[model samples]
Structure formats: structure tokens, C-alpha cells
Target: MHAALTFLLLFLMAGTIVPVNRHFRQTPGGIPVFVVSNGVHTDVVVPLREPQTGTDWLEQLQQPQLTARFGSYGYVGFGWGSEQFYLASYGGNFPKPGTVLRALLPGPTLMHVDFYQQAPRPGKRVVALQISRAQYQQLTQLIRASFRPDSTGATVLRNAAGYTPEDFFFRGRGRYHALRTCNDWTNATLRKAGLRAALKAPLAGSVLHQVRRSRFHAAAQ
Candidate 1:
């Protein structure tokens, strides 16, 4: 009987261990969506998977498939990794190079909340970025303002704020990459503020091409 009990315990332990480890190693294809007015009024949505380009994943989720059944005022972005892991003081240990997480835009109400890391992946590699309703408007405005008549340099313009010409796009473990010119800037800024080690690196000149803007005609108009 004692031997039997020991074997059961061992089996249970192994069962728990495998899942916990698997979640940590799995690459995040997308992120959890939330519409929270504060810590109190919180509505949680399941992780949204990346959809094919031109498909509006956000609107589809907002309808009823999302458990929370909440409405969003904007779309927010961030990174992810294991929850309890410690992130490097600087931007070291982000993820394997070249992975990118892409979420289709719905409207503006969705805000970027904290990135969730499920389990054992080390170094808190997953990251999150949150924005208030006002911030979301400002971001969309910036994107529109910086948008050129041609799409040729739009990517650079989206990422140019506070970055030198050399700032190129990189990804974390969960396939998260910056979409616009300021996305990288915003991520780097958040990392600098949240993690001690995320250093500001020089941007390559070509990278700057997308970011340079003359002015927002909307302002003058």
C-alpha cells in the first residue's frame, strides 16, 4: 500500500510538471485582451490569436466569442514571456531573434495591457504595454499624422520617435514586433522604465526613413 501511494504521488507530480514547463516554452502567437476601467471594473478576454492580414480579428472577438463581452476604445501592444521569471535589467534575453507577433486591428478602444507569461520560461521575457483611452487616440493621431502619401516610409515614420536612424525591428520569444514607427520607441521606452537593463541603442539610417515627418497637415487644416 505504501509503495502504491508513493507511485501515485510521483505520477501526479510528473503530470503537473509537464504542463507547467510546456506553457513556458511555447511561443505566444498573440496576447490576452482586456477592457478595464480600473483595477475594479475589469473584463478579461481570452488570448487573441494572430489573424491573416486584412482580417479584422478585433471586431470578430468583440462580437460575442470573447468571454468578457466588453467594448474597447483602442488597440494596444506589448511583449510576453514566463510570468514569474526575472527579466534582465537591460533588454537582454528578450527571445530568440526574428519572432513577431501580429494582431489585426479592429477599432481604437482596445488598450495594451500587461503581457501574460504562463509558466517556466525564464527571465520574464514576455513584456506588456498599456495605454489609456486618451493615449490610444494620441497614438492613432500620430500614426495618421506621420503617414505619408505613399506607404514606402510609413513603417519608419511609425517607429521614429526618440529613436535615431539605426533603430531596427527585433522580436521577443512570443513573436511580438512593432507595427508602426513609434511602436519600437514605445516598447524600448517601456522597457527602459520597467527594466533596469534595456539600453537605448543607436538606430541605423535606413531605419529612420520610415520615421521622418515634415508635419501633420491636419494640424494646419
Candidate 2:
């Protein structure tokens, strides 16, 4: 009982301190991008096609298999997490204690991609960010690099039955653990894109809070 209580205290403390520090900066010549959350998970959304660059990269990469899946609006969202944990949790089967424990250790990760027919709306759970075109390109590269591509340079797809048809999972680059979690991936990607984020956000709440703070600060300026 004492050990269980100690662990509970540690978990609570982790939420408060894992992120450690927060910072915000405005990227010059930035374009509009989005940070979206679904209470527990967060995703970064970017354009699927850029008229200025004449690049239909998503269409080119996905080709015949997934090209038809996306709609005219042209946007996609990317997220990363423990494969088992994400599949089980999102499929409505909450992870068992053993599953959670396994995920807390190093484990395989998956990258989730969702196609949106239109730009996602900003609400309580979503915030728009303006970052330079170069930053957006950097963010895209970060996401693409997270996937473990196959011999043909295509991302390996996994079967995630209950998730939306428009979304797919790809084998990811690193292991997922308590310290390097899904939200941490999001925070790291934002930082790679030259955006402001918490130093290390293990929880979606910490990431969303930092994004919201930056959005609010930008608005005030």
C-alpha cells in the first residue's frame, strides 16, 4: 500500500514538473498552421498541397493507394505514440495495467496520419500558429523522418481497425516510453519547426497549455 501511494504521488508530481520550462517565440514570414487536441491527444496539422510551391507532395507520396482517400480541402494531421497503447486506447479498449507498464518502458512507436477535407476548425481544443514557410517545411520533414519507410520508401502501415478510415498508422522511428511519449513527439516537432514549446512535455495537457500560451501571447502582440 505504501509503495502504491508513493507511485501515485510520483505520477502526480510528474505532471507538474516533467515539462520544466516553457518559452514562446514568433517566427517571421510564418504561414498558418494548427495545433489540435482531443482532450488527451494532440496533433499538428499542415497543408497537403501548397500552390506557391506547386507541390502535391502528399498525393505524390501516397499515390494511388491513399490519394483517393483525401478530399479537396488538402490538409493532414500527424501524431505519434506507442503502437499498442494507441491502438488499444483509440479502439476503445483501455490498456490493462500490464499494457500500460509495457508502454512505460521502451516500446515500438507508430505515426498516425489523418486526412482532413478542410482545415480543422479552431476551438477550445485547437490553436492556429503562424510559422515561416521554412518552418513549415521543417515540421513536414520532422514528421516524414519519424516514419520508418520500407524498401520502396513507403511507410509501413499497420492494421488499426477502430480508427477512422481516413487515418493510417505507420511504423515509427523511436521507442516510446514514459519520458519520450506521444506529446513529447509533438513538442519536439514544434521545437524543430522553430516554434515555442515546453522543454519536455510528456502529457498532452502540458503541450496544449504551452501552445495556447504562445497563441495568446501572439494575439496580445
Which prediction has the highest lDDT against the true structure?
A: 2
Off by over 4 Å in 1: 1-123, 151-184, 187-221
Whole-structure CA lDDT of model 2: 0.75
lDDT of 2 by residue, 1-221 (tens): 99988986577446534443245455544566788888777899888886644546565456456765564657888899998888777655678988889999999988888888888888888888776667677877888899888889877777543377778787888999877888889988987776777666777777777676663345545
- Over 4 Å off, model 2: 1-29, 53-57, 160-162, 215-221
* Candidate 2 accuracy as TM-score: 0.82
**Candidate 1 lDDT, 4-67, residue by residue in tens:** 8898556633432222111111113323222222211121222333232232323432323222
Full-model lDDT, candidate 1 = 0.25
Q: For all the candidates, what are their Cα RMSDs to the real structure? A: 21.9, 3.8
